[model samples]
Target: MSSDKKVRQATATVTELILETFRLNGRLIEAGDELVRPLELTSARWQVLGAMDRSAVPLPVASIARNMGLSRQAVQRLAKELEKGGLVRFAKNPHHERARLVTMTEKGRAAFAAAMAKQAPWAEALAEGLSPDLLSEALAVLRALRVKLEGHDG
Candidate 1:
């Protein structure tokens, strides 16, 4: 095949992958929202809490956003809402004067635990028929794509 045609074919495949990723992301968020709704947590809130829970130390909103690949403003807004719901609290950051550390409350911990408990079986079922090797390959491809996108200015 001509090099130009090969390039077009590759670009078309990448575009399809991007679109499918977007659809999958939306569906995953919707499923997550349903899974945690009984616990009074939306997917976005759960994500922020999960980030905090996974961190070795409490992080500022900016740090959480960076870890999660989200916008700082979006994370800050979610943090404020989580704080208002009594799920998390903002404490003084010994390093940054204005950027307070986000800590999960007891309530937050319970909610996170419950959400994770729910996730275990759900994830298992989702993976039931999938080959582990294929799953690993998919994960690797997605991570590589993410790294490429992160490095791109456009």
Candidate 2:
């Protein structure tokens, strides 16, 4: 076979894999929605909370959006809703006058902990047959793709 033929085959396989990843993302989001339902949280809210929970210090809406691969406007909307729910509070940002830092309240932390507890079992069950090394490799590949995509606008 020709080298050009091999390149085209590889490109086709990568395209198929990307599409499969999107399908899996939809399923994962659905499962996530179910997992956090008991905590009165949707997958979007849970993700925002999770990001704040992971951060050592408070972050602005833009930072949260960047971390979550979401738009700043979308994160701002979630932050506003979370704030109204008393799950998060905004603080003055020393660096920026208008951009406030978002912090999870104790209530938010408790909810996140509860959701994490439930996620532990679900994740373990899902990983029942998967190899740790394989999972790590897959994560690395996905991260690499995300980095490349982030650098491209279209």
Candidate 3:
């Protein structure tokens, strides 16, 4: 292809990627909302629970925010609700003088386990025709692109 044609194709690809990201984000939000409804949690709150479940050790609210790609204040608020629900508990972080660590409570673990059990079949069906290789490549490419977009030394 000519240089001009290549440039146009690249631009179009980027544009499509951006638009599809927005579209998929909406779907994900909706799916999350629906997924957590029976658990009586919002999508954000559910995500906080999931973050706590994934942490090797109790993580500070800031750390969870960074991991979950959410604002600290937002996660903190959701954490507060989760705390009230007896799903997560706060402990003092050894590394941070002022930050409290958040960890999943047994209730939180049960909730996550139950939710995943219900969701597994749906997820499997969604991926029924997808190849593992393609998924891995997509993840790698997206991660690299995100790093480059962030002005990181990717």
Worst 10 residues of 3 by lDDT: 145-154
lDDT of 1 at 93: 100
C-alpha positional error of residue 61 in candidate 2 after TM-score superposition, expressed in Å: 0.2
Candidate 3 at 104: error in angstroms? 1.0
lDDT of 1 by residue, 46-132 (tens): 999999999999999999999999999999999999999999999999999999999999999999999999999999999999999
Residue pairs with clashing backbones, model 2: none
Score every model by TM-score: 0.94, 0.93, 0.88
TM-score attained by model 1: 0.94
Leading candidate by TM-score: 1
What candidate 2 gets wrong by more than 4 Å, as runs, is: 152-154
What overall lDDT, based on C-alpha atoms, would model 1 receive against the true structure? 0.96
Give residue 149's lDDT in candidate 3 (0 to 100).
71
lDDT of 3 by residue, 28-101 (tens): 77997898789887767778888877888889999999888789999999988889999988997778888999
Q: Would you list the C-alpha lDDT of every candidate in the order shown?
A: 0.96, 0.93, 0.85
Please identify which of the two predictions, 1 or 3, would achieve the higher lDDT against the true structure: 1
| Candidate 2: C-alpha lDDT | 0.93
Backbone clashes for every candidate come to: 0, 0, 0
Measured with C-alpha atoms, the lDDT of residue 17 in candidate 2 is 81
